[model samples]
Target: MNAVTNPHILVVDDDPDLRDLLATYLGANGFAVASAGDGAAMWVAFNERLPNAIVLDLMLPGEDGLSLTRALRAKSSVPILMLSARGEELDRVIGLEVGADDYLAKPFGPRELLARLRALLRRSHVLEAESAAAAAPPRFGPFALDTLGHRLLRGGQEVALTSADYELLVALVAHPNRVLSRDTLVDMLRGYERDPFDRSIDNRVTRLRRKIEPEPAAPVFIRTVRGEGYLFNPRGGQP
Candidate 1:
């Protein structure tokens, strides 16, 4: 269960029946539920009140799920779980690549949806708590981690960070100049169960490098230490 009380969830789908069902089920399960029929409606609901998490459908009219996901990711780090009727692997990959945190195929059980949603919420809440628990906000290079606000600021401008990105960066910043292995990072971030070949950590590193490093192609802030793992260079000159 999420530690946050009555976390609001926005459900965006064209199917009115499905929308009502999810709203009812999620509301019954202690979530504040809001429903939207399409992309326009979703945006209206989103602007009126930002949701704790979003349940987006892939095949919405006007703006598709991938497009909406990209737009949302550009603005906020809110967790998004995308739903699609087609269970194709390519679709799932595309969805994830476009910034959907999790993907679910149609014909899924309500219990399974609840479980996945809960897991995402749990991770998000844990990240917030960790930030709030920090004794003092950490600073590195041109960035200042606003632990109390749960935000990353560079030159007073807030930088958008996903839950995974924020958690990974927090872990790296906490232990500067140390080579952290993939397994160690996964454990530290409380990452979802991943296969042996999962490159989630590496992907997150690339994303963070793009955001913070002077040269992402040759990163100085986050250096790859050969076969060991990654090392954070807080001073950020030569890695």
Candidate 2:
């Protein structure tokens, strides 16, 4: 988190212009940037010096981004943000399924990409510090919130969570068993503002339920009020 020590990020994209643009853009934003055109070049840079994170393009030649992601995940826990021209829901879901920390579609704003990278790096740094200090995560509902580690666990096993899911869960758990309004949850997420009739909050709650609740259809942990927002029921299970 030191301004003096710029975080190194490797940008893997086949497009030369995109690579140069990202390198220039990210470099000005206080990040040490490296560029790779394909999977082979990515390894070359990785071997030269492992980066704090990787911005991988999903449509690489021969070995695609997902393949590299699966292969790298088996060896390293370094945070990865997958990029793809395909912005479908299925694509995003698949990317997260293969251990990606986050996903971004093509033609995204430089600022947005920078924000996502910073969040991922920040989470990684926090987890490393917590592990070194032997810190215990907050516990509730048969789950331990590894806030710094950015993953939930129950019965000493890792629980999968995407970046968005983890952030929302953390916000809810911080004020456990309390009714948090949609507006308040939106502020916590820092997401884009929506119309008055927005169901963004409900959508997020549904996603969280599928992951944490034993029965998503009849969710016991995250309960919804008819007119109000959702509440985190600590009755999920004994901590």
Window of ten residues with lowest summed lDDT in model 1: 187-196
Q: How close is candidate 2 to the true structure, as a TM-score?
A: 0.59
Model 2 lDDT, full chain set = 0.81
Q: Could you report the Cα RMSD, in angstroms, for every candidate shown?
A: 10.3, 9.1
User: Could you tell me which residue pairs clash in candidate 2?
Assistant: none
- Per residue, candidate 1 scores C-alpha lDDT tens digits across 4-23 of 78989999999999999999
Give the C-alpha miss distance for residue 230 in model 1, angstroms: 28
Summarize candidate 2's per-residue lDDT along 45-106 as a digit string, tens digits: 98898899999999999899999999889988888999999999999998999989889998
For each candidate, what TM-score against the reference? Answer: 0.59, 0.59
Off by over 4 Å in 2: 1-4, 135-239
lDDT of 1 at 71: 96
